[model samples]
Target: MASPLITLRENTIWENKHGTVSITPRSLCDVWNTWVGPGVSNGPIWRPGLAGLRALVAQAEAQNQRIRGLGGAWSLSPAAATHGIMVNTKPLNYIELGFRDASLDTAFSGNPDALCFAQCGASVLELYQYLEVRGYTLPTSGASNGQTIAGAVSTGTHGSAHSIGSMQDYILGLHMVIDGGRHCWIERASKPVVSPSFCQAIGAELLRDDALFNAAVVSFGSFGLMHAVLFEAEPLFLLEKSLVRMDYARVQAALGTLDVEALDLSGGRELPFHFEVVVNPYRVSRGQRGAYVRYMYKRPYRPTQASAGGSTWVQGDDVMTMLGTVTGWTPHLVPVLLEPILSAQLAPVQGVAGTPGFQFGAADLRGYVMSSEIGVALADAPNAIDAVIDVANRFHWSGFPAIRYVKGSDATLAFTNFSPTACTIELPSAGSPRTLEAFHRVWDELRARGIRFTMHWGQMMRENREWIEYGHGARVEEWLAARQSLLGATGQRAFGSDWLTACGLG
Candidate 1:
C-alpha cells in the first residue's frame, strides 16, 4: 500500500489577528491512510492516517523538536503557536458514525445511535452538515461554526444553552498521539464507550480513566495531538427564537435565576433551550435602559418545506464586524453612537424556528474583533455584571458587555466549572488599546475583590499564573499533574508553548 500524501513547507509565517508565529518548518497531510500499505518504513513516516501522524510525533521526538497542531486558527490567543514545527491538520477532515458493540469492550453501554467520530480537522459546520444528513445534530456549539472540532473542544468553546454545558461536555472519548509514538484511546472509566475492536480498527491502545480523560478534553494541545474525538450527538431538533429589549432590572433577574416568569417572555413560563442577554453599559439609566435578550425554546424536529422559514437566520459576524468598523472610526463616541445600533439590531421579538446549525450560523468577525469572557457562578452574576459595568462606565469602554449562561462543564480545566450553572460575561469590540486596557482593569478588579471567576482560554486574558491558580485552585493542580503523568517531560517539551509556560501548565 502507498503512504498518504504529505507536504512540508519551510520558513512559513503564520498569523492570526491577535498574534503571529514564524515556523521553521510546517507539515500538512490529508486524512486518508492505509496502515498495511506498501513501502512501510522501519520507523514512522509522516502521513495523514494514524500511522503517519504517529510518524510525525516520532520524528519530533527524534529531532528534539516541538510540535503543535494548527486547525482553523480561530483563537484570539497564541495558545496554538510554537517556534518549532507546526502541523496543519485542516486537510484531515473526516467524520464517521459508530454502531453498537463497536468498541472492543462489550460492557460499553453508550448509545451508538448518538455517537459521532469526527477527525480533528473537521470544522463545526462540516460536522453539522454531516449529522444533518443523517438526521442528527450537535446538542450545542459556539456562536460560530467555523472552528475546528478539536480546536473548539480543546479551548472549551461554549454556547448559551442554560441546560447544556460547553462542547467538551458532549465528548465521550479521545484519540491522542502522545510522545514516543504512542497512540492511545481514552474514555471515562465511569461511563465506558466503544469496544476493543473499535480501538484496534483505529490503531489505538484503549485506556479508561476519568481524570486522564477530563484533562485531555480541554488540554489546549498540551496533552498531545488530538487526532479525533468521539462525541454523543442528538436527534435533529428545531429552536424557536425571539429577541426582545428589556430593562436592566428584568435582565438582571433573569440572569440571576434564569426564571422565565420574571422576564415575561412571549413563549410562556417554561425555561428556554437557549438564553442570552446583551447590555449597553452607557444606557443604564431607567428611562434609557436597554438590554437585548434572546430566548430559544426546543421543538420536536419535523420535515418541512425548505422555504417555510425563508432563511431568516442571520450570521452574527455581519453585525459584529460592522460594530468593529464603527468602533474603529470613532472610539471616543462609542457610548453616544452605540445605543441606536443596539436598538435597531435587537428590536425584533417575533418567533423564528430553525435547526441548531441554522440558529447558530457561521459567526466570523474577520479578524477585526477582540473579546474577553469570564465565567462566574450564576448566583454571583448580578454582582459580577455590576462590577464590570462600573468599570466600563468609569473607563468609557467602547464595547458593550453581554451575558450568556451554560450548565457547568465536566472538563477538568473548563472555566465554567461553577456548580449548577455559570454566567459568561463577554465584552467584544474592535481591537482598540483602550478597550483592551479596560478589560485588564476589569480582570484586576475582579481578582482584587475575590470575586470567583475564570477566564475563557480562547479569548483575550491577563496571562498571570497566580491568577490561574487562584481561579481554578486544586483543579489546576490536578490538570497539571495529569499532564505530567501522561505527557512526561519529553511530551511536555514537544507540545509546550510560551503561553502554556506562562499559565504554569507546561
Candidate 2:
C-alpha cells in the first residue's frame, strides 16, 4: 500500500493566532489527509493515516530531534511548539462519528452509539457539524470552535458550563504514537470503553490504567503524539442565552456565592447550563451598571429551532485586540479610555438562543492579544475578582476581566481541578507592555492574599517551577511520574519542548 502524503517545509517560523508565542523550528512536517478504506469487521479504518503519524515520530527519533504536534494554532502559549520539527496535524482530520457495539468492551456500561473517534487534527468545528447532523453534541467546548480536538484536550480547554467539566472530561480513550513509532490505546481501567480486540484492530496495545489515562489526557503532547481521541457525546441540545449589563452591586453577591437568585434572568430559579460574568474593574461602583452577566439555559433539541448562529460576546479576543491596538497609541490614557470602549462593546443583549455549535461558532483572529486565565475555587471568586480590581485600580489596565465557572476535572494537570467547582477569572488584554506588567502583578497579588489558584496551559502564565508547584503542588509530581513511566527517558526527550522544560515539567 502507498504511504500517506507527508510534506516537509524546512526553516519555518511558527506563530500562534495572537502572535504572543512563536517558534522557528528546524522544519515543519505537514501530515496530509489520507482516505481510509472500509475495514473488515473490527479492523482499523485509519491504518494509513496512523502509519504516517508513526513514521513522523520514527523520523524524529532517528534524528534525535524533539517533536511537537501542531493543531489549530489557536493557543497563545508555546505548548504546541518545539525547537525541532513541528508536525502539522491539520490534514489528519479523519473522524468516525460513533462506535460500533462489536467494538465495545464486555464490561463497558456506557452507550457505544454516543462515542466518537476523532483524529488529532480534527477541528472542534468539524466535530460540532459532524455530531449535530447525527443528533448528538459535545457536552462542553471552549468559547470558540477554532481549536482542534487534540489541542483543546491537551491544554484542558474549558467553557462556562458550571455543571459539566472541561473538554478533557468527555474523552474516554487516547490513541498515541510514542517513542520509536510504537502506538498504544489508553483508557481508564476502572471504566473500560473499547475492548482489547478493538485495540488489536487499531494495531495498538491496550493499557487501561486510570493514572496513565489521566496524565495522557491533558499532557499537551508531552505524552507523545495524540493521533486520535475517543470521546463521549450526548443527545443534541440547544441553549437559550441572555447577555445583559447589570448593576455592579446587584451581581457582586453572586460573583462568589453563585446564588442563582442574585441577578434576575429569564432562566430564573433553575440553574443555568452556562453562567459567566464580565466586569469593568474601573467602573464598579454602587448603582453603576458595570457588570455584564450572561446565562445560557439548556433546552431540548428541537428540529424547528434555527441552527446555531453568530457568537455572543462571550469571548474576549475581538474586544481585547482592539483595546491592545488602541493602547499602543495612548499607553497612559488606558485607564480613562478603555471604560467607554468596554461599556459599548459589552452592552446587553437579551433572549438570544442557539445550539452550542452556533452560539460558539468559528472565532475571528484577533491579533496581538494576551489572556491569562486563573482558576480558583468558586467560593473564592469574589476575593479573586477584588484582587484583580485592586490591581486594575493601581495599574492602567488595557482590558476587562471575565469570570467563568466550570466543574472541576479529573485530568491530573487540569487547571480547573479545584474540587466541587472552579471559577476561572480570565484577564484578556492587549499585548501592551504596560498590560503585561499588570498581568504579572495580578499573580503576585493573588499569592499575597493567600488565594489558591491554577493557570491555564493554553493561556499566558508565569513560566517557573514555583508558580506551577504553587498551583498544582503534588499533582505536578504525579503528572511527571506518569509521563516518566509512559514515555521513559528516551520518549520524554523526543516529545519534550522548551515550554515544558522551563516550567520544570521536563
Candidate 3:
C-alpha cells in the first residue's frame, strides 16, 4: 500500500498566511484560509484544485476517513467540522457567469436557479465582479468580498434590504460532492428543471425538493462538497455608497425608539448601503464603550476614473493598508503609518476605478484576512462594543478592524438578518495564541447573554449546541437530507456529524 500524499503547515486564512496545523489534509475543499477545526487548524490550504480534491477524496474513502467541506471558514460555530478530510474549494475559483435574460423570478415565481452557474470556488467579490461587468448583480453579500460562493451561501450569508431574502434567495442550485460519493446538482423542485445529463455531467444525483433545497443551500458544509453553484443576478447598477459614520449614542437612541430604523442610507442620515461599527477595546477606559457606525448610500453604476473627473472609491489595496507585513517593527509604528494611510484612503475618489462596474470591495477575499476574525450579533449595536472591548481589555485584537452590518434575514444560515435588527461585530486579530483566549472569552460572554446571533461560517467561532439551536436548528437536519439526497449513490459524510453532534443536532 502506498502512503497518502499530504500538505502540512501551520496556516491561517486571516492574512492568507501559512502557519502550522495539528493534522495534515489528504485533499482540500471549500474553506477560507482562516478555517480551523479537528482535521484543520489555523486556516485553509494555500491553493486547492479539482484533481487534488478527487485524489484526496479517493484516499480518504479508501482509508475510511470522513470527508467534509468548508467555505469562508467564517462560521465561529463548529459547523465547518473539526476532523477528518477537510477540502477547501478555493482553488476551484473559476467564475464564469451569465444570467437568464431577465429577473427569472418574475417569470418563475420565487423559484431559485433562475440564472448563471458559478464554480464552487468563486468568491463573492469574483461573482460581484462578474455580474457588474455584465450588468448583473447578486441580491446581497457580506460587507467584505472575501468569502467564497460556496461558503457564503452554505452559511446563509445575507445583505440588507427589507424585501430580499438571504444569499439562499438567489441560489438557483449548486454542484455538490458528498462524503459517501461524488458530486451532484441541486435545485428547488419549483425552479426550472436541470437536465439529468447535467446532473450526471457533474457526478451527482438531481434533487429538487423545497425542504431539501432550503436545508442544503445553507448546509454549513455538513452536507458535502459544493463544487459549483447557479444563482440569479440583477441588472447591473451602482450604489452611491451613501457612507456615514455615526456615534454609538445615536444608534442606541434610535434602537428602542425606532430612531435608527434604517440601517443603510445616504445623507438624510439613513438608507445606507454598507453599515458597520468599529469597537475600540482599550479605549473604553477613556470613556469609549461603544463603536463608530459607518453606512453607505446606493447610487447608479457609472464607470469613470476619479482622476478622470469621477468620484473616487477605496479598493482592496487601500484596505490592505490595514494589514502591513512590516513585522518586527514596534506595534505602534504600524498603526501610526496605517492611520495616515487610511486617512488618505478616505479621501474622495479621483482615479477611475472600475470593478466589474458598480460595486465596492472588488478584491477577491478567497485568501483575504489580516488575521482571524470572530463575528457576533449584538443585542444592541451600542452595547455590542463590550465584547470587543473585553477582548481588547485582554490585549487581543491588538489591531482593531471595523465592524460591518447587513440587514439579516429569516433564513436559517444568515448571521444577522432577523426580525429584529442585529449588529454583526467582527473582531479581527492576528492568529496568535495570546489572543485566542480573549476571542474565546468574548464569544462566550456574548453567547451567555442570550443574544440571537450566528458566527461567520468562514472564520473561527464557538461550537456549543446552544449556538446551533439558535443558529439554524431543524434547518441543519434539512441540510443533511439535501446532502444525502444529492449524494444518493455515494453514502458519505463531509465534516461528518461533527457539526451536528457538537451542536447535539444528530
**Model number with the top lDDT:** 2
Q: Assess candidate 1 and give its lDDT.
A: 0.77
Q: Give the TM-score of candidate 1.
A: 0.92
lDDT of 1 by residue, 1-506 (tens): 55555567666677754442333344433344434558665532223466656777888878888887877887777777776767777767778866666453666555677788888888988888788778888989987687899999998999898788999998988999999979999999988887777777657899888999988899888888888899888888988888888678666776788887877787778888888888888877676657888888999987743211133335332244446556546767766777887776666766777788777676534435678889999998888888888897888866777788999987898988888999898887666778788988898878777798999888887778788877788999899888887887898899887788888778
- Displacement of the residue 48 alpha carbon in candidate 3, Å: 16
TM-score of each: 0.92, 0.95, 0.70
Candidate 3 per-residue lDDT, tens place, 1-506, comes to 22223354323232122221233344334333232334432222322343345555666666766666655554444455445666666656666554333423343553333366776777776677666656667767655566688877876665443335457766777766665345556677777546565555345577667766666676666666677777767765555442333344445444322334654333555545544445344443333333344444555656544211121234422242344333224443443354344334343332223332234453322212233343344345444455555556565444554554444444444555445454455555433455466667766665676544566654555556666556555665555565565554333443454556655544
Clashing pairs in 2: 308-358
Model 2 clash number: 1
From the highest lDDT down, the ranking of the candidates is 2, 1, 3
**Model 2 lDDT-worst window of ten:** 35-44
Worst 10 residues of 3 by lDDT: 12-21
Worst lDDT window (10 residues) for model 1? Answer: 304-313
> Residue 307 in candidate 2 has what lDDT?
52
Report the backbone clash tally of model 1.
10
Q: Which parts of model 1 are misplaced by more than 4 Å? A: 17-47, 100-104, 304-322, 327-332
RMSD of 2: 2.7
